[model samples]
Target: MELTRLKKKLVTAVKGHKLLKDKRDELMRQFLDLVRENMALRQKVEAGILSANKNFVIAKAGMSEQILNTALMSPKQEVYLEAGKKNVMSVDIPVFETKTRTADANDVYSYGFAFTSGDLDGAVKSLADILPDMLRLAEVEKSCQLMASEIEKTRRRVNALEHVIIPETQQNIKYITMKLDENERSTQIRLMKVKDMMLEEAHHYKEKEVMVE
Candidate 1:
């Protein structure tokens, strides 16, 4: 290729490399934030589940099987959840919204207070409260997985541009420039040689004229 065209391509490659680096950095920042959120959500979910399980076991030991079954048969409250999406760095992360059917906290205990143990109430309440967080946990985890995949793909592209494409373009430009400069120098040398030969021939012709005189 010509030196001018090679230089133009090199400039374009450099610009592309810069843009990809910026995109990679922004993606890394977003990914890190999601990672932190995922970590916190995981810990909260685990602790909450453990506490709820402990309460459930205590309740089970205290209550008779028939009483426990009656208490669990009908739920006092219902929750409606809808999932949507939000964009983060061009990725669509899930958004979950929970709508509770019952507004009063007292309605959470559907079973009669006289038959069920306090431990059972505590367990039921813990599970209900954690449901939203559990949904949030699902959202964050899925987002993390998606972001990690995108990051990996972007990293590969950035590496290819930085390590391979840009370097190869620069080398090609250098090679073309050197060839053009060499051609220019060779043309200049040939012109000088031709001019010197013309002067030598003219001088001999002038001496012949002087001899004739």
Candidate 2:
């Protein structure tokens, strides 16, 4: 007893469902990519941290043996940070690159000591100490990039479901319901007419028989 309008609405809803499914697939693909990137960045950060720890231990040992702090210490030098913006899936994150002089307080060496033997080792070790932090920054930046991309993607999907997909489905349902109602009404009217015609014919037959008799 479905009406034409209702049938058309069902067809529309099917089309909308297909479209939403495609959108969901695309969002999932993007999400997976971001997750992979995040994992890789995390591994890199962990490695950097391990390396930095090793460097710190070596530096501490060297400093203890040399007693070079008073004689080798130099004035603090400026460290400049230059950050660049990167966009991943419409998420902007700042990636910092450091520009600093190689010279450090520990870089100065006594005349008799080899250039790479004592304080220079300490300077290199200090750089290693900062390496972990630098890697951490990198990790944070990558994570932010990944998260932002995912958020935007999720937002779009949610919007599509709420505003477009769900509404379209409901619209189709409404149309189909109306069509079915109209069809039912028409069917009932036709059935009533048929019933009335059958009754009238029966009455005529009975009158004819009675007259003949």
Candidate 3:
């Protein structure tokens, strides 16, 4: 009975190991995709920031510091961000949403267009255009981080199941089977001895009765 139970447990462990392995593989694939996306987004974000900075520098150089500061003093835009989560392979990954409210194109330039250099407008527009991409980059990067962590955890579980639980369960089953076999052999030997003694006793009784007759 113990041996049968142990075999059942071994089967369960093996099945569980397979499932964990599959999950790990899927997680790894997702992780790699997220990594590639992160790399590309990082590059694009870096380039956008650099270009915007260069434009800002040119605008600053072309205009007085006071005028530039005045132009940027009053903001006509507001941004709202919401964060949530989505499930992937039993792992929860964060989702980010961005909502932007701008007064109007007319109000984007706080100061007169004549007072501000075209470079400033270019810089502002470029930054504005990249805002959504920047948010996307942030979301992707964070998801990559989370997915990497989950993958590592899943790998550890898979390794443990493969190396430890399944092997140990199999070993237990083997041990129980060996013990049961030995017990069966011992019982057979005892039964054979009893049968031989019974036959000898019957033969002795028959000889005594014949001699009496």
Candidate 4:
């Protein structure tokens, strides 16, 4: 009975190990995809920021410091960001939405065109255009972190079952089965010797009866 139970446990451990391995593989695939996307998005965000910085530098060179500060002091536009979550393979991925307060394209510009240089306008436009991509980059980065953590946890569980639980259970079952077989052989040998002794005693008794007659 103990051997049977151990065999069942071994089967369960093997099956669980397989399932965890599959999950780990799928998680790895997803993680790699996220990593690729994160790389591309990081490049895009970096380029956009660089371009915006260059435009700002040109605009600053063309204007007085007081004028530049005044031009950017007041904001005509506002953005609302909403956050939510998406569940993927037991991981929660973040979803972000950006909503501009005003639909007017000109709302992004805080200063009148008469006071600001074209370079300032270009810089502002570049920032606005890259906003969504920046947010997306953040989302992808967070997802990658979360997925990586989950993958590690899954890997540990798989290793425990495959390397520890399953092997130990199998070894226990083999030990118990060998012992049971040895006990069965010993019992059979003892019974056979007892039967031979009984037959010899009966033959001796029969011979004595014949002599007495």
Candidate 5:
């Protein structure tokens, strides 16, 4: 009975190992895709920031520090960031949403046009345009990290089932089966010896009865 139970457990372990392996493979594939996307988005965000900084530098060079600081002192635009979760392959990844307080495209310009240079406007626009991409990059980066962690966990489970549980169960079943076969052979040998003794006694009794007659 114990052997039968172990065999059943072995079957279950094998199936679970296969499933975990499949999950790990799928996670790896998606992880790699996310990694690529993350790299691309990082590059895009970096480039956009660099360009925006260059615009800001040009704008600063053109105007006095006091005027530029005064112009940017008050910002009309307000950004709302909403963070949420998305499930993918059993991993909960982050989802980020961005919304502006006002729909007006010009709301990004905090200062009046009369006071601000065109270069400042260009810089602000650049930063505003890259906001969504930056959020997307963040989301993808977080997803990649989560999927990588899940993949590692799945891999460990698969390895444990494949290398440890199934093999031990099979070995145990083999040992039990060998011992049962030995016991059955011993019982058969003992039964044959008893049958021979009974036959010999019956022959001896018949001889004694004939002699008395």
Candidate 6:
């Protein structure tokens, strides 16, 4: 009976150890995936930032030139911004579209310039041109944040399984296995002693029968 109990305990411990190992492996996979995603997003964010900077420089130079030229020509113009929404990776970014109008209070100064004559136009155009970059940056930033959060959560889970939960379960399994082993040894010793006593008694009976004969 004791041997039977030990066998059952050993089986249970082996099963529990396998389950804990599987859980640890699964958590590690999840954590690795999140890390990969975070690295990709970071790369994209860097590229987008560089592109945004280049666009800003070009836009600044163009606007400066346009401002000087417009001032010299003394042309009057009005510009308005109409912005629309652009969705990138579930993040909505504003894309400003420009509308320019030229109005002459009197015919003293005739407006003979392109829609891209003024600083405001240049600024608006620059903004519109960089809208895609802005959107990319937003998407990358948000994705990075989300990935980082998920990675942290996954890491914690992995740590718990690897360091605390799995180890505790394995320790318990070891303890149970040891107990079962000890019980089995004790039972085997008891059985051997019982068999030896039975053999001695049988020999004594044979001796008595011989003496009577």
TM-score of each: 0.89, 0.47, 0.94, 0.91, 0.91, 0.51
Query: Model 3: which residue pairs collide?
Result: none
Highest TM-score, which number? 3
Candidate that beats the other on lDDT, 2 or 5, i.e. the better one: 5
Global CA lDDT of candidate 4, please? 0.93
lDDT of 4 at 164: 88
Model 4: CA > 4 A from native: 104-106, 208-213
The list of candidate 5 runs beyond 4 A from truth reads: 206-213
| Order of the predicted models by lDDT, top scorer first | 4, 5, 1, 3, 2, 6
Model 2, CA-based lDDT = 0.61
lDDT: worst 10-residue window of model 5:
104-113
Cα lDDT tens digits for candidate 6, 41-64: 556656655655565456456656
What do the candidate models score in CA lDDT, each in turn?
0.86, 0.61, 0.86, 0.93, 0.90, 0.56
Instruction: Report the C-alpha lDDT of model 2 over 1-213, residue by residue, as the tens digit.
Output: 444555566566567656656655665565566567667766765775566557556656665545445434543444567767766444465667765466454432333344334434545555555554665457565755565566666567667756786677677767877777999999999999999999999999999999999
Regions of candidate 1 where Cα sits further than 4 Å from its true position = 210-213
Error of 5 at 79 (Å): 1.5
* Residue 136 shift from truth in candidate 5, angstroms: 1.3
Q: How many pairs of residues collide in each model?
A: 0, 3, 0, 0, 0, 0
Per-residue lDDT of 15-125 in model 4, one digit per residue for the tens?
899989999999999999999999999999999999999999999999999999999999888999999999988899999988899887667988888977999999999
Cα error of candidate 1 at position 139, Å:
1.2
Over 1-213, each residue of candidate 3 has an lDDT whose tens digit, in order, gives: 788888888888888889989998998889888888889888888888899999999999999999999999987777789999999998888888876676453345556787899999988877877777798888888888888888888888889888998888888888888888999999999999999999999999999999999
Write candidate 1's Cα lDDT for 1-213 as tens digits: 476776787788788778878877898898898789889988998888999999999999999999999999999898898999998777788899888887776578779989889999999888887877799899989998888887888789888878998788789878877888999999999999999999999999999999999
Error of 6 at 60 (Å): 15
TM-score result, candidate 1: 0.89
